[model samples]
Target chain A: MINSEHTAIMLIAVPLLGAFTTAVFGRVSSSLRNIWVLAILASTELLAVLLGVNVLEKGINVYALGASFPTLTSPEGFPVRIILEVDAMNALISLIACTITLIVVVYCLGFMRESRVLDKAYTLILLLLTGMLGLTLTGDLFNLFVFFEVVSISSAALIAFYVHRGQSLEAAFKYMVISATGALILLFAVAIIYSQYNLLSMAALAASIKYTFLDEVALVLLISAFLLKAGSVPAHMWKPDAYGEAPAPVAVMLLTSALVSLYVLFRITYTVFNPVTPTIGWTLALLGVLSIFLGVSMALIQTKLNRLIAYSAIAEIGFILLGVGSSLTQSPHTSKVGFNALSGGLFHILNDVLDLGLLFLAAGAIYYLTRENNMNRLGGLGKTHPVLGVFFLIGLLAVSGLPPFNGFASKLMIYESVYFFNPLFAIIGILGSILMAAVYVKAFYSVFLGVFPPQELGQIPKSMLAAMGVLALLILVIGLYPATVIKYLITPAADALINPGDYIGGVL
Target chain B: MALKWRYQRMLANIAYITVVVLIGLGLYAIVFKQNLIKIVMGVHIMGSGVNLFLISLGYREGGVAPIYTLAPKLEMVLPTPQALTLTSIVINLAVVALMLSFVMFIYCRYNSIDSQDRRLRG
Candidate 1:
């Protein structure tokens, strides 16, 4: 029988090994390299799922490194080495990261077939997966910072893959600057926490935190750095630039990367600073409102297709943040309300990944066919590529939070729960969703419904269609079974977040 | 307090002030500088300042190195921060290399390192 502990280690190790082997052997035969990558990713995703199920079934899974026999606590009864602590919350997110990465890897086969730097792209993708897996799985604070750097550097390289395009390199530089700065600040926060408690383990820090001035400084630093990484309003300039300039497959990967940052943001706010500080929670809400307002409003004015979707993505993040922010009110009456808000927020993470992922794939298909990203130049794709049009329609409806779609289920929860907090905020949230719908509808009209362009569009690749088809199918299934998903996946993850005692106990 | 002891306290304060000043300079450069290389340098300076602060956290008066071979029984400085600073310094190296390569790419593409002339401007 395969131990679940081994699954945790394999989830990260396999990808790192595969990345290196692919880079070395990829030069000999591209097809062989592609198959190798697919197989590696397939196993990684399976193991991630297995790990998630294990965590869900048996509570938190702690795999201690360099121990006598891989136990949680040392002989002296204190955790001293690095550990992989997989609770329901991280396990679900780790599964989401792997699942989305697998889909994008499949898409990349067709998307980057003709590009000369295929080996580098594949290698970077695998390394990117390694970084993300490590980021979500590691129990040590310093290890998290290290893995965070891995994600940022690999992603920055992937964003600038098309070096010939002047703007892409420009985008890459901006992304690197922002990420590097955020990472250093994050490291400084880690240092601060380390200095205070003389420990690097997250659970230990959480247990020992005194909420001192230094702790507050660390908290502010962490919130600001993660908020910036997740591309909230004040620091969101990098998102549209990076997402719009990256290749479609890479853009999808970047979306997941940004989601990891969001995951960390919630993890820190909830676990490290649990019982949700009223001020911090409200501060997060304020940022969420701005992101929603700016993202949807700016998306309305964008003429470019990718940039528009990117802006809409920012707005979607706002919704998730809103749900998360609502959970910060800690009164006894509001605790029930906070749980509901957190569940909605958690569910929205999955919904956003699927919906935005589908839309990006549709956008990629359109770009793949026409080599055009400007809505001004794209016209009548509905006639030439009906499959893409259908896919785009599903994405459009789902993202705008219409009923019978997964987005609607979560957003409705968000809308109701947030309403308990403030009626005006709920009203504004509804307005943002409405504006988001208009933005996507406008994009649909401009690109897919207009008069047929005289220029001929290329046929979409089968592999790309297969990728989109799978995403579209998942969206439909989740949309159909929202309650089942909520009961099984969303609630456990929320429980894990609200109660970090299990996480700390499992580690120490 | 004795004058010499007061001087020693001021000296210790100077060390902290220097770290703070270096961090301030780094942030100033990162936020206000236009040159890409200068921005990269700002990141470097900030990183160094933080690393310095980390090393300072491990300092002990008249303590020997925390090496087992040299001082198995002696009072030694806190070694964890030194270890952390080592890891951080390596990470900083990787970041600096990546940032510099990106600057090279930027120069090749736009022939300018001025952030204003870049196409990604808001």
Candidate 2:
């Protein structure tokens, strides 16, 4: 068995190594490049699983870089250098990220067959994955900022991969600008924390946090920057652009990238700030509600399929925020209710990953077939591509939180708990779900059940089919066994977040 | 207060004000400027302002550079922020390069750096 300590770095290094190797060797043979990319991603996924297993077994694993040993602190007992802390929460996210990436890599073999910059695309994908893994796992503040940049830069580059497409460049430019500005603000926040605490390690800062004016400033800056990164409503302008223009596989990766921002938002609020104010929960819920209403309402009118899905994604993020936000309240009764909301939120993250991923892949299939992203131009795909129809239906059902799907299981929990916060919150959430359902149903009818076009359609590739099949299957299984997953994965992940002292204690 | 102490305090205060003013200028440019290049420059200025804030966080009056071998008895400025400033500078440099490359791509495609270009309404 590989030593557990090495697993964290291996998770990051494997992808970084693959990125460079594919860049150099990919030009030699396309088949060779595909195999190389597949091998590294497969291994990375394995390592992620191993790390997750280790986190469950070992509680929390801390790998201090450049230290003589796996010691937590310097001779003076302060955490002085960079560290990678893998808790159940980070482990779960890393696993989700790597799994989605592996699936997307498989799907891309077929999706990206015609693209000119295949090698560059593969390299950027791996780099983005590395950035995400590091962002999820790193314990150092500065390191997180660095990895955030890595993810942003690569994602922007990937979004603009279709250079001939004019809109792609514009989307990439907006995404790049927003991401750069957010990173700068985040750095300023980091500097503020450092100036006060004289430490860069998150655990160290958490142990030393004073909740002063500077701390509040840092908190606001951190929240806004990450909220922008995650594409919340007011800050969500660039998201639809990036997602609508990026290649299908890259679009799925972009969702995970947004997820990383959400993860950071949770990490900063719960761990670093440790619920400094009671209002945090309500504030998140307000944002969540706005995102849900705006995202779904806007999604209703979009002409293009990808943009519609992108809006739905924004709404999905809002659901997660609402569920998690319910728990941030200070009332004892609400805190008890918050645990349930937290579980729902955590469970929804997984559901969102698979459901949204399946939809994007299905959209890509349609795009692959008709070469038309405009929904008005798409018609009668159901008759020609029955399996994709089923896949699309499954994705639509899951996303709209229909019964017997993973989304419903999580959404149910959210509604049940959030009702305790206020009946109106749950009511609005239900109303949003209804609107979301209507939007997707319309999209499905227009795209698949409408008039059949005379143009010849492209056949779906076996690899792409397999990728979608697996996601659909997982969605079904999770929906069926929601209790088992909640008990094992969601509960522990929520506990990890709810109990910040454990995280700080483990490192300090 | 001692003359030396007063001067040092004034210097540090000026540094703090410079940090604030620089960041304000950067934000102004970003929010008010229409040109993409100016916005990119604003991002750079904001980054520099943050870097300056970090470096100033470690500054100590009458302190030597944080080299132990050169001055063992002198009060040394904290070196951590300097190190952090270096890292932030490199990251910012990477971001600036990326922003500029994006600007080039945008210019090549749209023939203008105006943020108002409505190629994508999203």
Candidate closest to the true structure, highest lDDT? 2
Off by over 4 Å in 1: A69-79, A331-334, B1-6, B70-72
lDDT tens readout by residue for model 2, A1-508: 7777799999999999999999777768889889999999999999999998888888988887877454446554645557888899999999999999999989999988987789999999999999999999999898888999999999999998888887888888789888888998999999888888888888878888888998999999999999989998889898899999988889999999998889988988888888568687789888999999999999999999999999999999999999988877752233667889988988999999999999999999998888889999888999999999999999999999998999999999999999998789889999999999999999999998978878877789999999999999999999999999988888888889878888897777
Residue B42, candidate 2: C-alpha displacement in angstroms? 1.1
Task: Looking at model 1 chain A, report the run of 10 residues with the lowest lDDT sum.
Answer: A68-77
Error of 1 at A478 (Å): 0.6
**Per-residue accuracy of model 1 over A383-418 as CA lDDT, tens digit each:** 888889999999999999997888999999999999
Model 1 misses residue A185 by how many Å?
Answer: 0.8
Per-model CA lDDT versus the true structure: 0.87, 0.89
Tell me the lDDT of candidate 1. Answer: 0.87
Query: Could you tell me how far off, in angstroms, the CA of residue A443 lies in candidate 1 after the best superposition?
Result: 0.5
- lDDT (C-alpha) at residue B39 in model 1: 94
- Residue A416 alpha-carbon offset, candidate 1, angstroms: 0.3
Checking candidate 1 for backbone clashes, the offending pairs are none
In model 2, which runs have C-alpha deviations exceeding 4 angstroms? A70-79, A331-334, B1-11
User: DockQ: which candidate is best?
Assistant: 1
